[model samples]
Target: MPILEDLKEYVERATGLRRPGKRKVSDLARARKPHAVRFKDDGLVPNHPRWPLIIYRGAFEFDERHDPAAVIEDLFEANGWGDTWRDGIYDYVHYHSRIHEVLGIARGKGRVRFGGKKGRIFTLKAGDVAVLPAGTGHQCLSADDDFLVVGAYPPAGTYDECTTIEDRPRALMPIPKVPPPRKDPVYGTSGPLSKLWKKAK
Candidate 1:
């Protein structure tokens, strides 16, 4: 389908046709930060030695089965911007260095867990934008459907080179054995952990 029609379909599904005309193209761009496209090439050449800073555009494709490992390779090649796939609803562990991720939701909806403590459950119809900062442990929860998200990173490098999540076995923890919370319960705040406990109740 045409991109506008696709976006309209999603808006209709997500907002129940609240105001389709009000949705602007800039809205999507505003939701997600601009993908970084410039880089400083300062270490490889001589006198002109401080290699002249060169900006490169990055690109990648994502689908249901694209491997994270393969995506990393593409990222390095593009100086670190590419699409990534999560086989199913899964958690992306935290990282130390800052990364700017601009994601466009091609399908599905769920919660995004970040900063190891805070999270927001966002229902994406399609063409929705989600921007996340680094040092955040991200994951999709309460997701009943599959999704595709295109992400962009800066300066072109691999997660392995800048992050510790890959080095530690327990870094990217498995999906918690609990659902997201609905309303506050007697036990604790309405959260994933609390929901899990409620399930056991």
Candidate 2:
């Protein structure tokens, strides 16, 4: 079923056609301070050394009139992030070696561990968004029955998942080389991501 869903998503993205409905992609976002944290390499995870993981709490204020998942997709697409997918976080620790990622909480709530075994655990509810730089490890600690996450990536890099110590050698090369997204998935050029990431570089 998951494979079928992924194929459908790929087709949708390839065709540039989203699920049809009256989408409210207007002003549903809230201006919030982005909380950023840097994580070190745990030998296995090879987390990004320079870029910090950014969290935007209550980034969007959603109501019954809006589909939270669709709202996230719209916002991400508008900001030049593509290849959107909807699913829950993985149970085991994993990182994307070649590209940065943004995860938006669209339904229920979840607790995720960022970085590796030494990373911090965050409780994310609906409307929260987390932007992870390349090679940042993430694992799902817990989630509600209805928990759902909307994830997307920038057009700069290819997507590859790394989970084992053996993958570290191959992952390290591209971790730091991955280019930062020009716009925040939730906010455009004026968002904190622009200045924060720029200053870090």
Candidate 3:
């Protein structure tokens, strides 16, 4: 174990793998709250009461991949977020009732309305990432023809499109019970998602 640790340190040093300085909350991650990104409530779909929308701006940029989806897929997988897929946002408003979701905007730009029909709109570009907690409503307001996103969920969680009132009862029960992600999709265990999710009211 000691040899492995020494080797790892040496490799990191040689490869310019600078260690993260500390776990302090970054200003970017503190857009609305310590780790929350509140959206305008559309009055149709109630956002996650405990976990708000999380936006990590420019999380994956300046990369040689030239493809946003590839970078996001790799990032999500590295942080234990699986079941990833590449696609564009839905035109109609919708929400997931069971599992949380992360969307990495890899290409183009678009305005997204979150928190149901009455939600607020935000223009998202490549390199921006939005982490939507379960039950939060979202939809693509408008976008360029090339708009694309890479989305994934934490391990053991699966997504379900829920818009009907009947879905609420079943949705709420699973959200709090949905196990906390082992690590934040961008910052790992020390990131905002780790600090916010599973937090007591």
Model 3 spans > 4 angstroms off = 1-35, 39-43
Best candidate (score: TM-score): 2
After superposition, the stretches of candidate 1 with alpha carbons farther than 4 Å from their true spots are 1-80, 83-89, 96-98, 118-121, 161-201
lDDT scores of the candidates, listed in order: 0.32, 0.86, 0.69
**1-201 in candidate 1: lDDT tens per residue?**
245434643554465443212122212122122222111211210001111111111222333443322332232223323434323334553432323343444455556543333333345433444333332334565554455544444333234212243433332222122122222111113212223323332
TM-score of each: 0.36, 0.89, 0.76
lDDT of 2 by residue, 132-177 (tens): 9999999999999888888999999999999899998999999999
Q: What lDDT tens digits, residue by residue, belong to model 3 across residues 19-68?
A: 32123212213233233566544445767777778777767643442234
2 or 3, which is superior by TM-score?
2
Comparing 1 and 3 on lDDT, the stronger one: 3
- Sort every candidate by TM-score, greatest first: 2, 3, 1
- Any runs in candidate 2 off by more than 4 Å, and if so which? 1-26
Lowest lDDT sum, 10 consecutive residues, model 1, at 45-54
Rate residue 59 of model 2 by lDDT: 94
